[model samples]
Target: MAKQKIRKGDLVQVIAGKDKGLQGKVIQSLPRDGKVIVEGVNRVKKHTKVGQTARGSQTGGIITTEAPIQVSNVMLVVEHEGKKVVTRVGFRREEQERTLPDGSKKTVTRSVRFAKKTGEAI
Candidate 1:
């Protein structure tokens, strides 16, 4: 599987579907499904039967909640200049030196995500 560019808590803008152009923070990321649930976007109504719970409390009715949308339909939002703008995400590997218990130094590479538009680490 490929690495997911969008993660939970990222600000993103919808570029397709009925919620196009809407910006919201990502509430959840489903990398396996290639979908993300954004706050205040792709809302869906769910109906349930009214029934009693173990505590005898009523628990069932119409509920409105966010629905997952395709990851490709959204673009990551980042601060560029002095304004917020949507941009593509890119990955870069950074190397760092680490000291071992044997008094030896080793170099390790880690993947980092960045905002392509501003070339800034995210």
Candidate 2:
């Protein structure tokens, strides 16, 4: 599996495709397929036949919903200065000292993500 940089509920902008320049929040991420479903992006319409079932009556017609787009097509949106900006993401390892139960301090390394532009945590 690949590392997922774009997570759910993240605001992103479409960099390619017909929805270029459109911005929306990520609703779902499909890391296995390298795709993500963003709010109001890559919408597809489906037509269904009406049927009666035990659960409920189905009267489906033309329904539109978001579809998955390649992860590379979207970029994370971050607030910079007073406006939103798009930048590449990078990870860093930070070392921290922790006190164990034995009263001995041990150094631990943790992974952190930040924007490559301003070095701000995502």
Candidate 3:
């Protein structure tokens, strides 16, 4: 399994491939395949034959929809200083001392995703 940083509903920009430079919100994330489906990106046309659905008889023709793009090919977008910018994501872990019910102190580490360029939490 691949570690997934980009997730569904995240605004991302295509960093490579045929759709390079296009930005869109993530519609789905396939962590198992390290791929994500972004809205309005990677559009592909599919020809379909006549078919019937539970709703009723469906009209089928050339349908355009989004296709999956590799997770590594997209970068998350964030607002920085009034401008939308793309940045690499970095994880920051901080340990805090917490007092248990028995009065014993324990350290707990929390993980956060931040933009590497601006150091802003996302």
Candidate 4:
């Protein structure tokens, strides 16, 4: 599987659903599931149980929490053409460098180019 361009802390905007057009920072990302939980978005309430034996806790009430949204439902917010926009992957940069498995220099290169649209370090 390919790595994701969006990270846990990336700023993203919801592009679909009732939360469309809403923007927030990513709180968590599940690359395997291609879902991300944005802060203060997709809020859902969860029922809680109050136990008589509690440590300095008096009451238990409904807990509101953010739920994970599909990654496709959100777009990576990026600055392009002097405007903030959502973008896809572009060209990749070629660099002359390789990590050695045994702590030895195996290969060396010069420059690497990355996708300007997605800001991915390709």
Best by TM-score: 1
Where is model 4 more than 4 Å wrong at Cα? 52-54, 80-83, 96-122
Q: State the lDDT of candidate 2 residue by residue for 1-122, as single tens digits.
A: 76988989999999999999999999999999999999999999988787777888667678898989999999998999998999878889988899999999999998988888888988
What pairs collide in candidate 3?
Answer: none
- In terms of lDDT, the best-performing candidate is 1
TM-score each candidate. Answer: 0.88, 0.85, 0.83, 0.69
TM-score of 1: 0.88
- For each candidate, the alpha-carbon lDDT, in order, equals 0.95, 0.91, 0.92, 0.77
lDDT of 4 by residue, 1-122 (tens): 76666778877889899899999999999999888999988999998787655466566679999999998898777666677776654445455656688877655545443446657553
Global CA lDDT computed for model 2: 0.91
lDDT of 1 by residue, 1-122 (tens): 88899999999999999999999999999999999999999999999899999998999899999999999999999987899978999999998899999999999998889999899999
Clash tally for model 4: 3
Q: Please give, for residues 1-122, the per-residue lDDT of candidate 3 as tens digits.
A: 64698978899999999999999999999998899999999999999998888989787899999999999999999999999999988899978899999999999998888999899888
Q: Residue 6 of model 2: what lDDT?
A: 90
Residue 92 deviation, candidate 2, in Å? 1.0
Better of 1 and 3 by TM-score: 1
